[model samples]
Target: MRTRQRWPILVAATLLVAACGQESETPDVDQNAVATTSCASSGELTMWERSGGNKAMVDMLVEAWNTKNPDCKIKLTYIPHTEMVGKIAQGIASGEVPDLMGMDLIYAPQFEKAQQLVDLTDRIKDWPELKTASKGHMTVATFEDRLYGVPLYADVSALFYNKDLFQRAGLDPNKPPTSLPELRAYADKITALGGDVKGYYLPGNCAGCNIFTVGPLMWASGAKIEAANKGDEPLVGDGVKQVLQFTRDMVKAGNVHDGDRAENGETFHLQFGSGKVGMMGTGNFNITLAREQNPKMNFGVALLPGMTAGSSASFIGGDLVVVPKGSKRVADAVNVMKFLLSDDVQVEVYAKALNLTTRSDMVNNKYFQAEPLVQDVAKALEVGRTPYTLTFFEQINSPQGPWLKMLQRAYYSDDSLDTIISDAKKEMKAIADQS
Candidate 1:
């Protein structure tokens, strides 16, 4: 979940104050205290989740949960992604917060660090399934070694290639690019087919698109963009230049779609979906969207590769099921979360619907066993990573952020890659320091 909503300073300050103020009225929770809620607890709990493709899955799961536990029901509200943060802030300030919320995992660190979420370390620490859950989501939800949320679903990034185009270009459709040099070589071969078909596509103007799709390339090369620990300074490593140079070379060689520089993510997959672009990097959500755009188009997916061969990674992104602090229905909310994470719901409701399960252990379920693309995604869920920084939006996802600026200069201009990376690093360092 990369979203366009950048939290302003005022709202951030409001959330800090509201969360801290609520903490005063509520007694400090014992670090070892375990919640008494069971999966069968009978009560009503309110929850909020963002509206999008996941809405159908969420609604279906809630209905199933209600059917399973007639005595314990959930009232879920669908809020727009742009309005979620502000609404949550207002809810906290007015004491009108929901019992639980399924929020973007990227924002979990912010809420957890600010004490806006309930600590569930004691309750979830001993659960066997926790060992197999997606590490990226769990890492984002944890603050100071305490768990605050459970993964709701997974959205990982991967390279999508047009299978038909590969065959037409005399390339093996069964074997996709596994490394950066292979990707460039594949692109050159595809571009030589001559026509509107280019070798690759890029959403040049969308910051979210770049971070979600390109971030993993840097990570796969063993680069750490965000600090692993709170007190450590975040560093933009040399792998960034490798990614920038690769993209710039592709663009200069006319291997990328000409319209890519103007794409703002609204039609990110359309060019590739039209069967004109040979490959593109995007999230798992696009598998459905692209198919819907052109039902006859043939595509294949693989984990995005690093600079070297045999290296692969993905940006692990999705929603987390969190119990907001100050809720009277904590027991019921915890019970609902537990029920959702169970094997039955995870397999039947989520995997059956072609959605990635939050738990990696469910990858071998019948649904994933039937789809090879999903199997690749399952592997990504197991190894993909996400930044746990508190200023993710300001530093990476914002339209005016340093990450986007760096991409624009490096990919769309003739500017020196070294200078672009250096300037961006200073800007990122300043933002991280302020946080």
Candidate 2:
């Protein structure tokens, strides 16, 4: 859920927002045994992970890593999720880097292009857990035919609704809308039951969040924004425009929060967490945060509504841990990967943390089977795809990127839908064609 999940942004100047964890540090020395990609011996390993939502869980694992293999002595530091990737790219040039980086999948290709990460294609095949990794998770880190990162966990977007609101509106809590028109109707129904609560949490700004928010709608509509990781341009077809138009109509209906247009997605987390919003397109991780934030709030999750009833799609996102080329402990990093992908660690993530695991094999775990919200995520992942391509990283994810700009206009502009789609397709293709 790299691009698709909501990370609490820490830095105001950049898109640096995400919930994270804190940790210890390590040193640089000649790691003579680094050639052994096995976990038999010990060596100092340094790693950097993004901070926010998943921080505590990750910290728990890191603590276990240090204690379980004291000789390996792996030390970690939490970089603001916003700062992790950019800083690491800078670190590559400055020659100051960590042994491993738990990074967003969308950026892997860029690092690979810069020669900042070590390709684990050969080393990765040796790991059995890899076969369980989902296509969306692997799609982010794969460039051409090689893998550069091991997905630590996964995130998928879903339609999250306030069960209380649904019941009050006379809607069935067990049954959620599965098409865009039905979703719109539900939003209107919830809104009609006047209160401080809004029917839907729509984003007027923040393209960074929309990658999964509205992005899922486009995918569900059978729109191919582009080829998996490379293409001449994103296919801004009728489906994409319909999604934008649907949002526009909803915004016109005042189904969203009062100040939704002015803020980026970061605010929705607080709103949804507090029970002010009824429905929001969100990742699996938010299930825990919502409960912790408002224990009284009852929530239900379902597949994001598609264009056609029963049709489903979601954007899979999450961090992929990669080894930077400068790190001497490549072997130790492999060991770290081994432990991370193990049943002990992943089971905790799915069962206790209620977060999505990168391994598809965990889909049937009794934990997810028991939790409806987590199950919604698993179902989404089974059919989910990542909105990544090997090109135009800046124009897509950047604050000033073309994709965000298109969304900004789509949600806020007075222009016609056809005009917006036409202009957006041109801009996207222009940026995509860049070197």
Candidate 3:
């Protein structure tokens, strides 16, 4: 949780075309083309991966696969996130893409459009464990109903509340807020404790902060900013505006931490660590940090409240494993995808990184059963969503994206929620049309 891994600004991916023309067979390669012959004899499987602050996870997976499957060797190379898109684009254009690649889920569709990936749609759904995958995970990995990548693991967001703060505020510790209105009311109660005890904190200056925090409110209110497909209708109601209004009212009420508006990832979590901050909307990893910082801190978890009950949502983060379209070793690459998604990999990876395993079956693991924080987190993962869309990098997360623009207007300017949201809708619609 204290991991200060800051992501540099992500870039918009240029649409890719599939790799064409097969490379001549080399030493250790079968002479018959994989398209003409079975790829069972395919030699070393070369893969490209982004080092998302967890290189060991990649190392462990590759080592495990190589040990067990001697015939299909996996060779992985790390590409910095800032350089991955340009490198992949060049590789695709040159028709020399790797056998498999690991990438952020948001960029998968842009690559898929270029026919730059192996079609995994037929293989992925049949994966019994995948049936338990959250709609958001499945949605992120799919383009035009075709599966393009396998979700490895993801960081999930859930509500973290100090039980001590709840007791002090006279709010029932067993019954946390279940609706957005209740969140404000409960937060106001906790905020009444003046000195250093803030009711809540939402990271404003942080890039991609809203996806896990306010984005869930929009989802719970049954709204989405972007359409999944062209000609699909925009979010039907005023849910987006409602989330904005709730946030604005909280600011006026002074429930948010004093310096919260200026906080990035590090400072935001530090507020919760001080033990006086009553509630925080952040990722599960923060729990580890809170305990490490204050051993006696008694905290609990709940879903991020929506407009109504049973409407909670979460933002899931992590990488997806994919196969490049140019690979002659499709069979072995597909095998690697399976191994990455297998229950064993999910559990082992979680041990090292504490990232929530995306698999539904892993909920039964004894580790989660005994760990209340992780158990609650696993529940959220069952419904967690990715901040993914075609052009997602440009429309939602990049410097000029609408989400950041909307936040700045709502917080730093005199713009009313109505005008801000109306403008956002138009920007989002234009992006959708371009898609």
Rate residue 252 of model 2 by lDDT.
77
Query: Against the true structure, candidate 1 has what lDDT?
Result: 0.79
Q: Give per-residue CA lDDT, model 2, range 65-183, as digits (tens).
A: 77778777768888876566667755665557788878876666656655557777776765677787777877767776788887766777888889888999999987889899999
Which candidate order results from sorting by TM-score in descending order?
Answer: 1, 3, 2
Q: What would the per-residue lDDT of candidate 3 be over residues 268-370, giving only the tens digit for each residue?
A: 6576778877877787777778999999988999888888866798877767778775667666666676776667767765644555666767767766666
Candidates arranged by lDDT, highest first: 1, 2, 3
Clash totals, every prediction = 0, 19, 4
What global local distance difference test value does model 2 have? Answer: 0.71
Give lDDT for model 3.
0.70
- The predicted structure with the larger lDDT, 1 or 3, is 1
Query: Candidate 2: which stretches are off by over 4 Å?
Result: 1-40, 226-231, 390-393
Q: Write the per-residue lDDT of candidate 1 for residues 1-435, one digit (tens) a residue.
A: 543445553356566666567642333334354543243345677889987637777888889877876776788999887678777766776677888889888878777777878887776788777788888998888899999888888888888899999999999998989898899999999999998999988778988788778888888877777543345555457788888899999998999878889888777756667888898887777778888988898889888999999898888888899977776666566667677788888899898988888888888889888877777767888669988787787778778888899999988899888888878877777777767
Off by over 4 Å in 1: 2-6, 24-40, 227-235
Per-residue error at 211 for model 3, in Å? 1.4
Location of the lowest summed lDDT over 10 successive residues in candidate 1: 23-32
